[model samples]
Each structure stands twice: as C-alpha cells, then as structure tokens.
Target: MRVALMITCFNDALFPDTGKAVLTVLRRLGVEVDFPAAQACCAQPMVNTGYLDEAVPVVRNFVRAFEGYDAIVAPSGSCAGSIRHQHGLVARRSGDAGLATAVARLAPRSYEFSEFLVDVLGVEDVGASFPHRVTFHPTCHSLRMLGVGDRPQRLLRKVHGLQLVDLPAAGECCGFGGTFAVKNADTSIAMGADKARRVLETGAEVLVAGDNSCLMHIGGILSRQRAGVRVMHLAEVLASHEGAA
Candidate 1:
C-alpha cells in the first residue's frame, strides 16, 4: 500500500515534532509511509474562512501532490476533515469538472491518524510504553467532523504504563478553530481558559490531543498560569517506547 503523510502547514511550521512523531509511530508499527515533498496546506484555512474561490489552487495542489497514494494519513483531524469534507466544495466552486473529479477521487482516501490506526491498520497497541498520567482532549474536527469517537482513546488505553484519564467536557471545542481564534480573540481566550481549567482538573501531567493547534491554545494558557503541565500530540504519546526518556 502506498501511504503518504499529509503534514499540515500548522505542524510543518509550528510543531514539526508532531510530524516527526507521526512518522516514528507509523514506522514503528511497520507501516512504510512516504512524505511527498510536493504536499502543502490542505486548503482548510481558506475554505473555513469562506474563501472557497481563493482555495482552488491549494486544493488543486493537494490532489496533485497526494494523487495515487493508496492512503493519505494526517495527524490532524482538522486537516483531514478539510480534505474529506471541504475540498470538494472548493473544487466545485472553481467550476472545474476535472478538479471536482480529482477531489472526489482523493478526498475519501485521506485518513486521520487515529482513524488510520484503529480502522485501517486494525491495531490498538503499537507496542508503545509511556508511563505518564495523560488526559486526552478530543478536537472538534476529530470528534464531530470525522466522527473519530473513542478511536483515539482506544489506542491510548493500549499504551503500556499509560493512564488515560477522561477529560472533562472532552467534546467541547477548545476555541482554536484556526481563524476563529484570530478573528475572535476575546472569545477564544475565554474558551481556552475554560479548557485549561478542565485539563488541570484531570490532574494529569500531560495533555494530549490529536490537533496541536488546539494544544497550542490551551498550552499557552497553561504556560501563563505556570501549570507545569506538558502538552503533547497524540502521535508523540503513541510513539513513546519503554526506557526512551
């Protein structure tokens, strides 16, 4: 199976480690994944911000870069959801039947990391061993957009020595909705503060979520409060092995 990693622009820039961790976990699981250099943003930002006309080139580039891969795996549900649910809209808006056809062919092949692991790979335990108290926050896109219910939790539960605590209001948005945070700073901070409070209530040493964008927002709040809590990508936690500190 030809599998490609669609490292979103957010991770490619701000959280490169998250992309690396995704490679680590997938490679450890015996999945030989490829990183197509031509890949770029999934055009989610433009689509979500009501700039579908402007997102045409990006969506076009996405399909071209990832074309022919049996599967395109993304660590972020936000990007994956965009590809699956939004790319088609952008293609149609461009009035390019060829682009529409391309989007139709490639979008369904995209898979969020957790969905790929639990659904496609059909493995719960990837032989990871992280001895830490971790709480997982289900990102809005992962939970609602992709319907990735309990898949992430199921994988976390199998990590040896890892204690997966239930995050209060796990389904609530962390207010890191890409441009939503920028356009609505006050509302975003308020929601992030609420999420930080919930993370602290778990008393977990680390906060884990599939999307680092959400983590960055909540982590910023925790950092300001000196919460001493670490934020890690779900891939990073899954990539952890015994005695590798």
Candidate 2:
C-alpha cells in the first residue's frame, strides 16, 4: 500500500520522534512509507483558534500535499481529527468547491498512527517489546473525534513484555486543547493537574497517548513536580523492538 506521513507541524517541530517512530514501525512491517515534505499544518490551529480566513491556504496546502496518496497517516490524533472532521468546513468557508471535494477525498483516507496500524494494516501486534508498566490516556480527539475506540490499548496489549494499566478517568481530556491551554491557563492547568494526579496514582513508569500535545501538557505538570515518569507517544512504544531504551 502506498502511504504518506502527514507529520503534523507540531510533531515536526517539537516531537519529531513520534513521526520517526511511525515510519520505523511501518517500514519494519514491510510497508513502504513516503514523506511528503510539502505537507505542513492541517490548519487545525487556525480553525480551532477561530481564524477561519487564515486557514484556507493552509487547508489547501494539506489537500494538495496528500491528495494522491492511497493513505495519509499522522502520529497526531488532533490534526487527523481536524482533517477528517473539520477541513471540509474550512474548505466550504473558503468558497472553493474543488478544495472541498479534494478535502472530502483526503480526509477519510487519513489515519492516525495507531488507527492506521491496527485498523488499516489489519495487524495488532507489531512485534514490539517494552518491559515497563505503562498507562494510556485517551486524548479527546482520538476518542471522540477519530473514534479509535480500544485500538490503541488493543495494540499495546499485544506488545511483548508491555503491561497496559488502566488509567483513572482515562476518558477525560488532558486539558491541552491547543489554544485552550493558552487562553484558559488556570482551567487548563487545573484539568491537566487532575489528569497528572491520576497518572501518578497508577504508578506506571510511562504515560502514553496518541497525541504529543496532550502528553506535553501533562508531562509539564509531572515534570515540574518531579513525578519521575516518562511521557511517550503510542508510536514510540509500538516501534520498540529490542526494547525501549
């Protein structure tokens, strides 16, 4: 299958390892992956921040970069959610019918990393090994937007030596709604603190989530408080073969 990595702007800029992990694991499975360098932001930041006019060109760039690929994959559920659910609306608002149709064709073809691995590739275990206690946080986008269900945990369950612990209030948002964290600092931090507290209660050595943005938010709180836990992206965990070192 011909697959392309969207490599969302945030991941490219901050959490590059997640994108690398996706590429590593997919190639290990013998599926050739392409990196479309023209790909950039999914315009989620502009759309979510109420800058609709500014998102048009960004959305156009997305559809243009990913249009011909058989499958477009990203490590981020938030950006994937935007493409699948919100990009069309942005296109319509731009008054470009062609752009709207292109987005329609591309959105459904886009899959978040875990979603692509288990759902599209029809494989659960990617033959990974990580001898550590890990708990998962279901970022709101992956749960509600993408509706990935138990795919993330299901894949993790099959990893060799990886223990998947239940996260308390796993469904709650980690309080990193992009601009939500910036505009509503107190509320965002409070919600993140609660999520961090729950993560600590599990005593897991690592906190895993599909979205790096969410992980970063909770990790900040845990790090400042010296919680002694590692924050990992789901792809990184799945990409582990010999062991996560």
Candidate 3:
C-alpha cells in the first residue's frame, strides 16, 4: 500500500528522529511510505485548545496535503486522533458541508503507527533488536480515543532481546494535553511527576510511549529528577539495531 507519513507539528520540530525512525521501520518492512512536505499541523493543537473556528483552515490543509495516499500514518496518536475524531467536528463547526464530506471520505484511512503495524501490516516482528529493559506508556489519545489496546505491547514483546515491563497503572494520563499543561501548570507537573515516579518504578532503562508529546511531558520530570530513564518513541525502539535507536 502507498502510505504517507503525517509527521505531526510536534514531531517535526522537537522529535525529528521519531519521524525518521518511523520511516526507517516502514521502509524496512517493505511499505511504500512518503511524506508530503506541504503537510503541516493536523490542527490538533487549536481544536484541543478550544479554537475550533481557528482549526478549520488547518483541518482543510491537512486533508488537502495528504490527499491521495491509500493510508496516512502518523507516529503520533494525538495527531491521528485529531484527524479521525476532530476533523469532522472542525468542518461542521466551520459550516462547510463540502469540507465535511471530504473529511468523512479520508479520516478513517488515517492510522497511528501501532495501529498500522498491527492492524494493517499484520506483522509484529519487523526484524528489530533492542536489548534493553523497557516500559511503555499508552498516551491518552491512543489509549482512550483511538483504543489502540495492547497492539504496541504485542509488537514490543516480539522484539529480540527487549525486556518489556509493565508500567504502573499504564492507562493513566501523563497530563500533557497540549495547552492543558500551560493552562494548569501545577496539575500538569503533578501528573507528570506521578507518571515519572511510576516509570522509574518499572526499573527500565527506557520509557517508551506512542506519542512524543507525552514522552516530552514525562521526560521533563524524569530528567529533572535524574531518573536515569531514557525516553523513546515506540518507532525508535522498533527501528533500533546494534547501531542506532
């Protein structure tokens, strides 16, 4: 299948290697993946921040940019969730029937990384090796919104030499809801601290998550506390070899 990588705005700027890792893994698995440079934000930020009116153009641009792919895969659950769940709302909020129709035609085809790997590609072992003790964090959108379930864990378990550990209360939110952190700093930090504590308790060298935004949120607390846990994207872990992660 011809797939396009919807590198979310957050990933494009902050976690570039995450995108590269996704590309590497997909290509290695013999999937034709491409990135439409014209693609930008999925408008998740604006919509999540109570700006549906402002998110209309962004939603439009997202649909327009990644228009022709058979599948649009994003390494981020939050962004993929935005496209699947919010685009219709934004189109309706804008009172654009044409846009709404276009979105309905496209949104279902967009999948998060784990969803694509498990549900679409139908393969868990991508011939990857990462000999490290690792724990995974199920981000809010992937867990609650997209309902990705244990697809990520299923894939991670098949990786050679990787010890997958259970995260304490793995379903809990990391509290990095885009603007939620900024609007409620104390609560965000508290939530992040709790997550970091749980991650440290796993005694894993790496703390992995489907969304970099959550990793970024929890990583900060882990870093400040000198938790000695490396934060990584699931794609990075899947793409890791003896050379790079």
C-alpha lDDT (0 to 100) for residue 115 of candidate 2: 88
How big is the positional error of residue 120 in model 2, measured in Å on the Cα after superposition? 0.9
Clashing pairs in 2: none
TM-score of each model, paired residue for residue: 0.98, 0.97, 0.97
Q: lDDT of each structure?
A: 0.93, 0.91, 0.91
lDDT score at residue 195, model 2, on the 0-100 scale:
98
Model 1, range 1-245, lDDT digits (tens) per residue? 99999999999999999889999989988899999999988888888888889899999898889999999999999999999999988898899999999999998899999999998999999888899999999999998889999999999999989998999998889988988899999999999999999999999999999999999999999999999999999999998886555
- Which ten contiguous residues of candidate 3 have the minimum total lDDT? 236-245
Give lDDT: candidate 3, residue 74: 92
Q: lDDT per residue, candidate 3, 90-135, as tens digits?
A: 9998888999998998899999999999999998998889999999
* Model 3 global lDDT (CA atoms, 0 to 1): 0.91
Q: What does the lDDT come to for candidate 2?
A: 0.91
TM-score for predicted model 1 compared with the true structure: 0.98
User: Pairing residues by index, what is the TM-score of model 2?
Assistant: 0.97
